[model samples]
Target: MRRSVLVAVMAIVSTVAAGCSSDPTDPAPTTSAASASPSGKPTDISFLVYGAPAEVKAYRSMVKQYDVDHPGVKVHLVEVSSADAALRRLRKGEVPDVFLMSRRDLGEIVDAGINQPIDELLDSRGVDFTDLYKRDSIRAFSHSDRLECMPYGISPMVMYYNTNLVDFSEMAEAGLDVPKNHATWTFDQFAEAARFGARRGAKGVYVDPSLSGLAPFVYSGGGSLFDDDRDPKRLDLASDGSLEALTTSLELLRKGAITPTPRELRSTSALDLFKAGKLAMMAGFRTLTPELRRTPGLSFDVMPMPALPDDRTLGDASGLCISAKAVNTSAAADFVVHAIGKDAVSDVAAAGYMVPANTEVAESDAFLQQDRMPAHAYVFNRSVKDIVTLPLIESWPALERAVHGDVYQLFYSRVIDIEALTKKIDEESKAVLSPPKASVTPSPSASASGKN
Candidate 1:
């Protein structure tokens, strides 16, 4: 009887093993389609993006095309008004399969454990990082020696001048030194241009009262924003090089006769003033091009940021990132590859706000838009070489907030103490740069005896 029971158990085990074995004739499963549900339902993934109306429209169109191209997958497009709003959503624990992120926010995003490294995935997807995209842009999204996101847009700040207000040809004829190349100019030449444009009841120029607005000048003057670029401990704005740069920039930026008066600024924004033909020059990025073109009577042109003995400028870089908790990472990565592809990037470039990281499309007419207002559109492309991206640090946003008032005072106040102001900026920055460690709480037993 015992032998008979053993035989029956052995037979049942063999049967179960055979049932679990795969059929030799069955097709292999594909990684790209692995996201499909067990019930054979199509995979669904979400893509979060934020931009202007036209830019949002372009992203929607891309999603629509991607959905059509891949019948087995559906992409849900989520539009936010701005990058800050998107970051808020992420902080609230709303994780999209894929999202657009500013490179500046990479440090914080990584610290939050929300983004996944995609270097191997991108390689598996056949993305040609070296040949297809800008090296600097790619580096902007890398952390811990791994690619955290795929770079999309790289826009360097440039000076946008009203053609009707500041006529370069006329300035040249009047014996004022004008930039012969139009893409390069010295600090003195920039000051002269500003003085010349201060006419027809218009302000000469307006540089934003913020760190980003002043960083390029600091860098070009052989100054550093931080004590150390890679692992910064404090702001170095009071250093000799930085002070010299600030002094030169302030000469033109602080002139009440040239820049918009405080009362005027409170009423009308510098951009609107420029549109109304009441402001001659302003510092802006590529995204401003499309809006300027659409302005009824606004004729504008662009130039590289004025150099302080060096060609340097700040750039805003953004990229596509995959969520660490994505339900379908394979599908999400596929969408990222699609989004940065030549055709997809081209469509957005045509909208005029994106300075595509895709080298091929950046050189195409889609971005240049020869018929547009900024006849010197090439300046945007050329300025890429001069772009100096800020270090990736989690405390950057808070640091900027801490120094905002001081920076504003430095730019706007008529009588100020430069040394004291810069020194204060450094001290305030230290609090964010190296926040104090949290104190340990005493246990009940230890507290009773006042000892551990």
Candidate 2:
């Protein structure tokens, strides 16, 4: 589920599970490893990133801001080649004082007891951890429903195409509106355009469902992820809406829209095909964020992920985590809060690293529709509510890898009926997402240092 962009070009979609990266806190473990020196005088803090240089730069700049303002805390930025590597370092007790990691997997690290909590620190800092993102998102890090992690940066999904490659003329011939940032379309129209691309010596789209780009498909189709209104974690993998979402994705593949031709998927990578502009509608996923779009030759635009049978948008958020082992809890917490604050939001958004997570940043005049990047900013406004909300089940490691992998298999196998596939997914999901029945166990050490 995690690997470098060099290993898999589909890393854009792979953002859902871009996998492990190196942690600056410790060296690569040979047979075994040791923890960071607790004896350092400067109070060194380590931050890991599974993101591009631009993001690293943005993160560094923000940290510098904290340094300038606080003047006492020292922060270290460790460029981890992947996210998983950082997690490994954390488990081995060699991770940075603060992870600054992205995704729910960070929450998994907290569950494993390697990280510390920062609620008290946040409260003292006047930062509203809960308000940074939607309520449900906060649950990603909850231990016994207490805060686990806070959202750092978030972006909405959209449709991205190499405009030079799409034949808008042909779209006019078919009376299609050539969808824009605000203008969405039905799956039928999307399929038609994809088939049109294929007929004209193109691959239509490169939307491998196994990637992060698959989020909106589930949401726009009106799918519910996990049934969490109870004590058990039940997955609704095969609900009518979910099944429709899955089937539509599969149908697009069959119609020559989403690719990796059953064979290419087995061999070549979706990112390779997409980078070649052979893909028509990538239906941009997490990459809609600025840090990602600025990657060297991405030469793409941010269009809202196509609408489903109903019009809905999908948004996703992942961010830096303050390790339970965090020593400079004050410094780490301050940096994360500022990163999502109004001060840095506009710059991050304008830089196109990711959609700014700040309410003000997303609506800033700088982000308003522009000539160079017309479809760039509207994503968050429309899709925030519709994100194929990330699954909260702790086995996300196993569930995301297993269930998602199998769903893709079913798409290619075409052996099981959609209904059967849905049923199997439902049964397996219920088992996988089920939560504990009793009150959550108390945290190992209740010494939280977060500020609100």
Candidate 3:
């Protein structure tokens, strides 16, 4: 009964996974053929996908195109409301030959003993791994260092500043400089400008306490919250870099240079205030671009997370995953390859959906010219060299919750001592992450592997 309930919950929600920070000590990924064999050619197979209307439409078009190119193969596309819905179908014996999902979801799928690695499939079909731009993204979906997903979207967290509230002219008059090049912007500069903006009748910078929003500050300062994502015991949030990041944020809050004041630390509120022109600066990923362009009377631009020198930000990718239970693995792998191929990636980018994971496609003008509203859309790729992927840890969801609980406490005035709070986070996170652990509510069950 417990296993059945866990599987049902896993079928209902595909949680949004947090990303990893920069790591130099990590080993490189090895490309080897998987042991699983692709099923022989078949005329029919299920293909499941989930997304908003436009994204769904975009994928349907791609599938149609693939059908047109393949004479004998017929791929049936199922549009589900969520990854959970599709997985529920899969569990009920409606297994899909190919499915679209976040790379983060790979762990749960692996844990359930469902999907097969695509290494051998790629080799058999001659899919070149080098064609993908973000190798880190590909690695994110791997289990025991074997590929299980074909990456499509590379979403990097970036800073969006409202020009209306920012008043660059006012900043210039106040002898403050706008960040023309993100590489040189420091935490001191960010805080100073926020204070200036606050005095000028604009709310200063506001960051939601989520790991994605908070990690950039830690990363820009050259600190890491976790050393090895795979190691439940590893923590560096108390390190000098982490301390500096936290201290700067607290100081800014105390000085009235930021918002979500201990009382307003709500995630959605940051975007709401940003759109209402109440905020001068906010942070988010490329996913926010389309919706941001739809807002009226807002002049905004995108920039890499401002840093002391070579800055970094959280990176995540979503793409195609094939099931081990797939009856036609050959056709499934073919569709997977086609879905992330040059033509398909170009179409996805042209729609301004996301940054393609293909090297040539990402560098193409299709994505770069997709919008002019964020005059600095080009800068989205400028920091490609600094993209960091989150580790593929089964314990991530539990650790994320434990860490975020403390973050909200600190942001909301419930926690005054930053050091003490972070230490508590480290403790709670270890308890959640430790193997052979005591009983916990979530219990690292099917949904525990699911996003949330």
Candidate 4:
């Protein structure tokens, strides 16, 4: 009875899964493929995608163009608000033929048995893995000695500062040290800038109250996120290097006079505050660019995360995956190959949010729109060299959730015990990272006492 109820809920969710379309004048989407073409029967395959409206529009445009370029292949686009939502559909057995997924989530998706190994399929489609995509990105999607997905976007975390609030020219005039190179700065310089920006009712900066938000700084200071990189048993935030990094970062990040107050943050997000010019800076990936561009009166530019003597940052890599349950595997493979090709990736890159894994597109005007707000767009391309990708672990999402509150407290709480807090965080993480083994059940024959 419970199973039937779940099926009914999923059926309803599937009906509305076509999501928003790029063009309002376009006809309503059909769950199935369009009627057979005159020349031959068309193969219908559904694709699941998620991103901002503009990014989604870019994908919709890509699908429209793909249909025009390849006859007798109809690609249905499925839009969801987030990766979690897409995973929900897959977990409910509503797997689409093809989907876009984050490399970090590869372990979870693979464990769920929804995604298929696509190395052979991609090779069959003539994809030049070495020449086409970024090397680290390709390695990010490999699991169990096979490529699980085709690398799409490889975005590293960068500092987005309001030019008006954190003026380099003003800093130099005031005798504060400015970066000799605009692409890089030191942690001490970053602190000075934050203090400089904290003036005239504007806060200096805001890093997200999560592990992902703090990772770049930790790693830049020569710290590790896990006790074991290959098979992490617990978080390593309490280790010597990691603790030192966090201690240094929190000194600046936790300054009440230079950051948003808890009450203010509860009322409005750091991103919204930054958009309103009430905040000086924040750390984000390429996806923040499009929305920031849309905000009026906001002048912003990108820079590498402040180096702790070493240039290091976190990365977000996404890829295209084919469903193990897909009926039209060949059709899906064709679409995946075409989607990552130069033209399709360029269309998406033009949207101003993606740092394409495609080598050509990464270096093209499509990504580095020289005319755009971020004059130093090359920072993104350069920062890729310093990205420290998190290890693929099935319980990553859960681990993050378990320690989120502690991480937030470590960043925002007054009078925090750094050592105690980090130790507690490591302990909490183990519950998710290395859960206890389940007890074995005894056989009935072994347990029997000759009594029924």
Please name the candidate that would achieve the greatest lDDT relative to the true structure. Answer: 1
Q: After superposition, how far is residue 375 of candidate 1 from its true place, in Å?
A: 0.8
Give candidates' CA RMSD values in order: 12.4, 12.3, 10.3, 9.2
> Would you list the rank order by TM-score, best first?
1, 4, 3, 2
Candidate maximizing TM-score: 1
Over 1-452, each residue of candidate 1 has an lDDT whose tens digit, in order, gives 00000112223223222322132112122257434567778799999999999999999999999888777888999999988998889889897999998877778788888999876666656566665566677667776556778889999999999988899899989988988886799988888889999997988998998888899999999998987777777899999999889888887899999999878899999999999999999999998888888899888999999989898998988899999999988888778878887788999889999898888888989888887768888888899879886776665678889899999999888899998999999888887776677899999988999865
List candidate 2 stretches off by more than 4 Å: 1-44, 114-120, 128-146, 167-170, 177-183, 211-215, 227-234, 257-260, 265-268, 286-299, 311-315, 345-351, 365-371, 414-416, 427-452
Q: Rank the candidates by lDDT, best first.
A: 1, 4, 3, 2
Model 1 spans > 4 angstroms off: 1-30, 34-36, 441-444, 447-452
What lDDT is reached at residue 154 by model 4? 92
lDDT of 2 by residue, 185-215 (tens): 6677677666666644557776645524454
lDDT per residue, candidate 3, 191-295, as tens digits? 666766564555777766666667777777777767555543545677777877767766665444456565454444778877877777877777777777789
Lowest-sum lDDT 10-residue window in model 4: 1-10
TM-score of each: 0.90, 0.72, 0.79, 0.88
Q: After TM-score superposition, what is the CA distance of residue 274 in candidate 4 from its true location, in Å?
A: 0.9
Q: What is the alpha-carbon RMSD of candidate 2 to the true structure? A: 12.3
Writing each residue's lDDT as its tens digit, candidate 4 over 1-452 gives 00000112223222322243332112232221334445577888999998888899999999999788766788899999877787778778888999998777787788778899887666544466655565667667765556778778999999999999999999999999888876789999999989998898999989888889889988999899888766778899999999999999999999988889899999999999999999999999999998999999999998899998789998888889999989777778777867887778999999998899887899999999999888888899889878876666775678889999999898778889999999999999988888888899878886795556
2 against 4, candidate with superior TM-score: 4
Which of the two, 1 or 3, has more TM-score?
1
Backbone clash count for every predicted candidate, in the order shown: 0, 46, 4, 0
